[model samples]
Every structure is written in C-alpha cells, then in structure tokens.
Target: MATKRWWVLGCVVLVVAASALAVAQLRKRDFQAICDGAVRGGSLRYAIGDGGIKASDVDELDSELPFGRLSECRASAEDDSTGLTVAVGNLESSSLMSELSGHRDLTGLSGTSAPMGGGWPGVLTVKNKDIAYATVVLKCGRSAPHEGILVNVKQMLVEGEGNFSSDKRKRLKLAQSGAAIASDVSKKWECGSQLGGEVDRAPDDVAVNKPLPLSQATGTCRAMRPLAATAKKWGITRAASTGSDSRAPAQDCVLSNSKGDRVYRLSALYGPLEAGFRKSSSSLFQVSGKAGRKEKNPGWAWAGAKCPDGSDAALFTASSIEHSKENKRLIVGAEFETKMLGAFARDLGGRRGCDDPSLPTG
Candidate 1:
C-alpha cells in the first residue's frame, strides 16, 4: 500500500509540472510582444517603450495567433525610419527562413558579419551598401530532432533609427535588441538551453575584413601560412578570415591571389547550414558527409569533423579555382590539395573543440 501511494504522488507532481509548462507556453505573444521584448532598455523608439509606443500598441495590428505563434513576425517604426523582422523554426528547415523576404544564406546577404560575442553563437551583419541583418543560432538540448532546438534571430537597422548615426552605433543597439527577442523566445518556448547574461556591443568581423598577408594571418587562417610556397605556385597568398571561436555556427577563410581573385576557400559549417552548403556549393561537398573527398581534376579536398556525443559533425572543405586550370608550370601539384585540406581540417577542428576531422592516411 505504501509503495502504490508514493507512485501516485510522483505521477501527480509530474502532471502538475507539465501542465504549468504548457500553460506558460500557451500565453503566446503577437507583434506587440516582440516590441516589448525588443529592447528592455527602451532604446528603440517604436519598440514598446518611450515615444508613446507600447507592445500593446503593435498587438493591435496582429490577430491572436494559434499556439501564440506567427508563421513570421515583423515590426516597423512609424515614418519607416526603422524596421525589424524575425523568423523562428528548426534550423534545418530552409523553407521557413525563405519566408522572411530578402533573407536566405548569410553569404547571399551583402554586409559585413561578425560574432555576436556575449556567450552567443551567432553573427551580426552590418550592411554597408545593400541588405543588412543580425543572425544568432542557439541550440537547446534535444528540443528538435538530432540537433537541438535551433532558432535564428536576425535584426536589421536602418540609418534613420534611433541614434544610429553610423554602422558602429547601429550595431550596438542591434545587438541588444536582437538578443532581447531571442532570449524571450528561447525561454518562453522552453527549449531547455542556458541563456547567458546581457549583451553590450558588437565585435568587429575579421573574416569580412580586408585581406591580410599570409604572414600576418592569425587564428585559423594561420593554418595556410606554412603552405605559402605551395600557394605561391598558384599565385595565392593573402587571406580573408573569420574569428577562431568554435561557438560560432559559421566560419571561413578565403585565400586570394595577388590580383585579388579567389584561389582557395576553406570553411567550417555547423547545424542548419551543413546541409544547405553541401547542396548549393560545388559537387565536391557530397563527400562531406563521410570521411571526405579528394580530387586532382578539380584540385579540391574536404574533411568532416566528429562532433561530441552522437550529434552530426561539422564539415570542412578546401577548393581552388586556379589549381585545376590547365597550367603545367603554375598549377598545383597532385595530392598537395589534400595537404591544404588536412591542414585546414586539423586546425579548424582544434579551434572548434571538436575531434580531429576524418582523413585517410597518406
């Protein structure tokens, strides 16, 4: 009798806890909620704060959504001086992201991107000429399938927005505002991930920055410095790089020839982007799912990293344009492509805190 009574009590507790969680999730937010949560500091004039703007004011524009979620969300300031938009879904589902209207892959967007940097695995794109947006991806433990719950939040700020005089000023407010909505959605949605503290400012992106001499390259980009002689044969020397932080979902290093043309490209891809890259990039990516592929015809090599636990591993690739072109004296020698591949694979995996990428013995 005592054993049965304890089991009944345990069941009741679990049921109550589950019910409370469900209720919290059911109280969903509309555009107004996005406004209220955009910047807790009341900095955004049109975002549920000062200037007589409130989230409730924006909710008036949207209907109560089912499950308290919208297929897509957008918030804009009066006079069109400022605007913000967001999309939430599994990172693997590209269809949902496409609905955001000008949002596709990060590479397709024209802007400089750098890590969000406050214990957040994301990037902020400051549009100099065309479209600009900030994107962050968070992984919640097993909330979604094989990968954790991945939510991408992008915030774009126009020049006329509050105090946004230059890209620097705009980035600061953009970080705070975007992080605010991301935090709210992650917690309210109960993705079971740790949300970090406040965000202060945006950091500079090294990858999008101007190319540096091979000798001056730092972090993961330094992996290729030892091969400068080999690259020189193909007229490749300078490198454009991203930060070395493994927490970032995406990272890149592009080797360019003296004339400022791409000679080789190297990258580290994680989560939602892993599949998209393989599909859109050259046919060489197909081998990324396995031990990696090597080819002398195209002068390319790719290596796949092993992730912790049972999750999918990160993918690394090195491809060169001039290496394969017909040039007896200037072309890259056979198997040297793999040398660059191995160098990048090993270096990138070390930086990202993953096991060494898979490579066949020479």
Candidate 2:
C-alpha cells in the first residue's frame, strides 16, 4: 500500500508540468486573437515573459473600426495596467502618435531612439525606462483609405517593476518586439511597405549625443566648433547633438549656456509637415529674401534642401530662448546664424543622402 502511494504522488507532479505548458500555449493563441491578427501573440511574450502576462492581455480599444485595415490593440494586465498598444489609421484621415506635428519635434521623445532595420522606414523611440514607442507608415495603393496607412506602437510599463526600467538589453528587446508586431500586421494587411531586417540596438539619447565641453564638441556640434567663440558672445558655452546618427528624418542640435539652459536651437525638418512648418513659422519670422531679395532676419535664419523624396526640407537656426540678448545679434548672431544654418544643413543632408541644401537667401 505504501509503494502504491509513492507512485501516485510522482504521477501528480508530471500532470502539473504538462498542464502548465498547455496553458502557456493557449495564452499565446488568445493573445493574437485580438483585432484579426493585428496583434502578434509572440511579440509581448518575447519582449517581457510568457508568465508575466495572462491570455486576457490583448483587447480592442475600439470595436467599431475595420477588422484588419485599421484597428487598435492593447496588451494589459487584468488589474488595469497596460504593457503596450498598437494602432493603425489612414495618414490623412487619422493621426498616428509618432507623426511630425507643427512643432520642431517629430515624436516628442528625447531619451533614446533608433531605426527599425529590415527595410521598414520606421523608427523606435524610448521616452524613458518605462515607456517606448514605434512608428511605421505604409505606402498602400488603391486608395482604400485614399492614402498611406500609419501604424503606431507604444509600450508603457505602469506596473512599477518592468524589466526595462534599467536594463539596456530589455529596452532593445522591447524596441525589436514592438517593431515585429507592427511589421507582422502591416504585411498581413497587404500594405506593400519595404519592411526590412530586425532592429539590433536602440542607444540612449546621451549615448547618441553626449553633451561635451563647447570646445570639445562632436557629431552635429563638431562642424560648428569654429563658431563656438562667436556664439560665446551670447553666453553660449556648451554644445551637444540632440540628433541621432541614424538616418531618421528629423534631427537637431542644441547650444546651452553655463547654466545648462538652451540658448539656441538648430533643426532639420523632413517629415510630411515640413512645408507646413515653414509656412506657419513665417508669421513670427519675416524670412529674409522671401521675395528673392538680399534682405536678412536677425531673430532666425532658414535654408531649404531638396530631399530624395522630391520634397523641400527646411533647416533653421533660432535664438528665441536668448531673444533678450538681441543686442548681440548685430555684433555676433548674424555671422553665427548663417554659419550654424550651414553646419546643421550639411550634417542633415549627408545623413539623409540628399544633395547639398540651399542656404536661406536672407
């Protein structure tokens, strides 16, 4: 009778192990069932862990949208904590969270970012240790939505103990998994986008553009190091590249005073709203040589570059932060404006593979 009891106990342990594996597989299937396969079941499982979430993590934010063309899926825990979200929409009729707005920023992210390689013209950005986002716009034909379809993926860890909090490896895995989900859905929807290979790494902003002493500037700030002495006349003593070396469209660099306050900003606009930014900004800026004259503007200067997409990308150098120091413009900002504008344009053009851009007529 004792020997019989021991055998029964061993059998119970085996049964529990098999049951656990079955449960995991079931959860994966349910995870991808949200929104007609737009959500990849394995994506979140790969980024985080299989046991970290339940099968109920995937849900439709809105049920009214189409099954496959445009949908939104959220990965969340039962206790109201969301791990990630993916949304799709038409470029013109709807707005993707990662698209460029009228502001100088494209995604409003500053912590870290990198390209989603594998031919997809997309980018991934990490806002902090807890939040990350990915963006991809597919050039679909037939005008179903009458334009391209945009996909935006965002991951926010509100659970207070996400693996990506400080682990650089986990952060990169998050980027890759986010891109993978978007890529899968884009392809399944029949949107013919040139999606490419997997993302290898996503470097932090400081790594991408570490702030250095003004004299020891590098990357975007390196080209303008010669003008560091001139810019110092306006209290600028530090230089840093806010832009990524990656060929991502929008990029910029910042100049700061000893107090770490940004005294000047130089930016390159290459998103769909590039023209809109230039037109709207004309309200505050007189835009030297607007009518093709040799006139000049002291507050700011802008240059135009013809992008490979046949669009005009604008580059600007602005000193709004130090506007009160306008008296120094005549003494130092004039030459500084033109030189910085050129420096920024060259760096941006080279990164994007565009021919040399034209300097502002003013």
Candidate 3:
C-alpha cells in the first residue's frame, strides 16, 4: 500500500509541473507576437509621458481633445524674432500611465480618477514656418510656463504605446532608491556601463560640444564615446562655412542622418538646432509635455520644385537639436504636431496604417 501511494503522488507532481510549463510557454509566445506585430506595423511612438498618442486622438475628423482649435496664420514680417504664429487646437487630457497600463481604452484603464493637474490643452495647425513647437501659455503648478519638453516620443510614433529604453530602466531604479545607492555593486554597475567601450579609449582631441549632423539625428544618433576617429567619419560635410559668409554661423560639428540629410544646424551661441527651429516659449511644456509643429518654403524659383513637405521632416529635424547653458547637462528636445502630415494619397492608401478612429480621448 505504501509503495502504491508514493507512485500516485509522484505522478500528480509531474502532471502539475508539466501543466505549468506549458502555460508559461504559451504566455511568452502571445506577448512576443503582440510586440512584434506592433513594431512591424510602425505603431511604436518614442513617447515618454504618454505611452503613445492614439489615432483617434490625432485624426483630423475626430474630436480627441475636450477643447480644440484650428487656425491659419503667418509669421510677422516686421519682427522676425516674434517667431512663428501658433494655432492652438485639440486641448484635451491625456494620461501617460493609463496608456502604459496595457488598457487601450482610457475608460477601462485604472487610475482614471487621478488628476492631470496642469498641462495646457494641446493645439494644432496646418500652416507655420516652423514645425510643431509648444508655447506654454499656462503653468503647471510651479513649473516653467514657456518651455516645452519632449516627453512623449511613443505618442508621436505609435500613438498608444510606451517607450522602452535603457535610460528609462535607470530612472526607475533611481526613483525607487530615493537618489541613494543601495549598494556598491549598483554604483559599480552604473560606472562600468557609462565608461565602457568608447570613454575608455583616446580621451583627447574629442569635440565635446561639436554639434552632430541633423540628417543622422534620426532615432539612431550614437555618441562618440567609443572612437573619436569613427565619430569624425559620420559627420556632415557641407556644414563648413566660408569666411565671407559671416551670416552662417561656424559649427563645432554638424548632425547628419544615414541619407546625408543635414537634420541639424549649429549656432555658435545656441549650439545645435534644426536650422530654422525655435523652441516653443511655453511653461507646461518645460516639465512633462512634447509637441512638434512647423512650416517651410524653399524659394519658389528652385528646380525640381517639390513644394517642400515641411511637416514631419521638420519635426524630426527639430527633435534632433538641443541646447543648454551647463556644460554637463543632457539637453533633450520634443516634436509636436496637431496631426501627422504627409502625402494625402499615401495616407488613405493604408500606407499610413490607419487605426480604428472610434477611440475617444475623454
């Protein structure tokens, strides 16, 4: 009797373990499929605050924000520094945590009751000289009111998703640690990663402040920490200015993309920028919001005259430029637009990956 009982017990244990393993494998496959599908669909936005901005919230016909406006305006000709005229539209409450919670519907998501506090309502425009730039007309609690921060790359790309980055992991750790190192191992780990590969090599003759080429400033601009020579080979060439061209500022360096597009232009004083871009003078954007808007006109007399599409490309260019007064500070820029703009024919042909427009922002 004892031997028979032992045999039964062993069989039961094996069966339970096998069931668990099968379930785990199935779950892994499901998640992997979901992630892969999302990426291949070009639905991934490099957003920070919002997992992603949804098509429902961004479509031209849909009402995504509680308050929205659309306007056509021009930059003041007399005061060139008055900058661009902004058309504020589609001001609504968007939740970053909700989008990241894996719940596509804001109503179904947990924490809907949480307050958004003070970010200004989003705006839109179909015309402007510069790409989407936020001007903080209001303040969020005590934060700055005239600056816009690029906090939602995911929303820009995949509209309803989250960005997964190595820096984000470090940030989570720092938040949990209350700004203190829990152990020596943690400090060592961070130091090793920071100084690994490139920083360990030739420490001399590297252009610390040299601006990167704009074309290369897409989502893949790597720093020159590994090899100064390797970095030099990847910069923009035509960026060098002539002595008589005093109007064109001398660049410490220029940013370029794989296609050799000059995505960034450098100013001797402001450092690097997307040529004509001027950061939005807004306060709510200074803390935790991102936007991209712009306008462009290449002299009408040019050959091969394609009416330069200055929308997304301008935003992409603007996002790559950064500036700061402090030497060691990490400067970041965000691009914002009321709606994604491109050739209308391609947009409707499904190349734009049209989303179900039924989702509501409220």
Superposition error at 287 for model 2 (Å): 11
Give the winner by TM-score: 2 or 3: 2
Against the unseen true structure, what C-alpha lDDT does each candidate score? 0.54, 0.54, 0.20
lDDT of candidate 1 vs native?
0.54
lDDT of 3 by residue, 247-356 (tens): 11111223333444433322110111111122222211121112222223210000000112221111111112322233121122111111111111112212213321
TM-score of each: 0.66, 0.69, 0.20
| Clash pairs for candidate 1 | 207-241
**Backbone clashes counted, model 3:** 64
Candidate 2 TM-score, true structure as reference: 0.69
The collision pairs in model 2 are 118-195, 118-196, 118-197, 119-196, 120-196, 143-146
Top candidate by TM-score: 2
Q: Which wins on TM-score, candidate 1 or candidate 3?
A: 1
Give a tens-digit lDDT track for model 2, residues 1-362: 99999999989989998998888777665554444565666766555555635433334454322333366666654454546666665543232233322132321224234444444555555556667666564656563433455566666776565634356675566667666776676666777655657677653343234467777777656666777777677677777664345344345566667766555656554543344344443233433431121244444556666666663354444443442344333223555666776776777677777667676543
